[model samples]
Target: MIFFIYQIVTKPLTSKLIRNEACPVCNTQDSLELTLYMRYIAMLIPLFGMGRRTSVICTNCGNVLKNPDSSIFAKKKYSNKVADAVKDIRQNHKRTLWQLVYPWSIWFILPFLILILLGISAINKKNTEEKAKEYAELIMHPQTGDIYKSTWFENGLSQGVLVKLMRINGDTLYVVKTKQKIQMSFSKDEWNKLSADPAAFEAKEYKIKNFSILKETNFGDLFMYNNDENGKQYPIYLGAILNSKCEMDLGFETIERKK
Candidate 1:
């Protein structure tokens, strides 16, 4: 008669019994040690029993085995679930990191660059308006204060002559006719205390009365205009105009003389 003797070892199993054993499901040889203490801890839990105690696990197939209870294969099931959850979390984390880094590294800089570009565009438009105003002032006759026009006459009959007028203030310019008015009225204190405040004062209008083109024998033809009937077309020098109440003043400086 033969008798089978079974003994429990106190020392934890260190040497692997099935070293490099390939899992039948996934054919992986990787395995980890599961000590008896860890097995006891797992077994004490209500969710784990002796049959579901810790043991070596196949890294690939996730299979588990026990010396006593292979039927209690709870560890393999739990491990597989945990592994799947971990894999999903890792994948999602990787995707999230990539998404955040990609935009911040490349696309995020666009807003600042776009703002700079918009600023440059606005500055360019302002500069262009200023230059256009300066050119218009250059083309206008300073004496007559009229825009110049070139025309051709047929049989001493000149028709369809183009007329233009331009005016400049600061960096801005306007076109006006001899019959129209551009009044500039202000108090003396206001004129003396000229400031950059845009709302400080209001502008008035003045009309152009007389305008004519004259021919000089020695010099070229001249263009002249007057704000009053008796006002002669003299070379306009710098001067200041005072209001009747002495509360307002206006200053003028000739930039050019028409010929």
Candidate 2:
């Protein structure tokens, strides 16, 4: 169980030393300094800003005067110099580049991630189209060492199955099914592992009519199914073949290996 952790971080943005200003607590001259702080919320990265706070401190006594006029400076007479200093601090207040950017980080971060996702989706779609074209070309050839990858939709879950062309005898094509059904949404490493080992494939070979069993769908993709009276397609049989590359580097000697 993991959760997103957020934190509130406070950082100093601007600081100004009030010259000739005396600390009311310690009576130390030229000790008062006013600082402006920016508060921001952060996750793994700094997300956005919360608010700001002002603080006044006495350097000699190491005392923090949060409110100058309402606290110790209440009894002291408000001088022209002190009032001008406050105005100067406000006028001179400026934030650094990071301080200005981190507060409104969400404005850019969301758009940046969205652009990345759209780029990835576009690449995947292009790859799928190219693979479909290769499959259409090789599906008609029906050569040995050719592996067909299909998605089996069952119980709202899709599982992947790999069928390999063992041999072709007369009008029948001998094919071997994979022992373990690969997940439709699987990693390349998982597919490579199953295809590498000979034991991962079924020992008994199945036979299907060379051209009769092979049929093209409306989308131009080829698949193996029975063309009986009701055009029955078995769930155990292979569905729409996704990949048509003769040699997928699955430790098989095919057209790619010869090239």
Candidate 3:
């Protein structure tokens, strides 16, 4: 359950002297003091000010005239002397600096945070695109240390495995598949662990016949292969590679598992 607690609170700000002013309610001379108050609504933080009120209280007669600047002091028209006195008091009253900044935190801080998040997201996407381009180039020119991480279906369940290139003979690519089959819901740490361990891969070599980069899409090229054992054709798309680092490449796309 979610609970929202908010309150409308009134806080006293600075007080100013209303010189030569008489309390209209008590007729007390030079006893009226003007105080400024701030009323605001708060939810976790002060949201905004409802309004400001100026009150005049007489120290001599103990009479309080709330919001004396509202045209009426005691059910009578405000005289020029009282009006000028209240105006001067209001002009002098100032709230503390903290009160000014706390209430508007959302207004200034939220947009700045949003912009920072957007900039980070844009940078991450740019890096991913750049890494994809680099991985595509690596795929075009097959290397000895190149690791091709691929996913395939096995026994009606999705499985993930890594294939490390041992060497590439003229038209054939020799590679070793990982012995441990990971679930499709794979983690980066799991991939890295398998890539770093030499014992995690198979002992024998698997040949991918007629292995060449088929320049098809702008994102990345495809590797067309003809498995010699089963005489089956399959594609290994370079775009499927999801590695941020070119050294330990991984894939999210599917490649048929060679038996």
Q: Which candidate is the best by TM-score?
A: 3
Q: TM-score of every model?
A: 0.21, 0.53, 0.64
Error of 3 at 66 (Å): 3.9
lDDT, candidate 3, 1-259, per-residue tens? 9998999877777676566777777776778776777778899788776666667677778776656345433563446775676677667766655555555576788999999999998877786677666555566666776666665444666566776777878867677778886765446666555553678788877665423434434222224355566776765432233342333323442222222
lDDT of 2 at 226: 52
Residue pairs clashing in model 2 are none
Q: How high is the CA lDDT of each candidate model?
A: 0.33, 0.61, 0.61
Per-residue alpha-carbon lDDT of model 1 for 117-182, expressed as tens digits?
A: 999988766765654444334433233343322121325442211123344443222333222212
Model 3: residues >4 Å from true position, as ranges?
1-5, 48-51, 60-64, 68-98, 101-122, 148-152, 184-187, 208-212, 216-240, 243-259
Per-residue lDDT tens digits of candidate 2, residues 1-259? 9998998887777777788878777888888787777778889777776655556778789876555324433653435666576667756777566666654677778999999999998877776676555555566567887666655454777677666778888766777767777776436565555563567678877666563344452231233335567886542343445434422323322112112
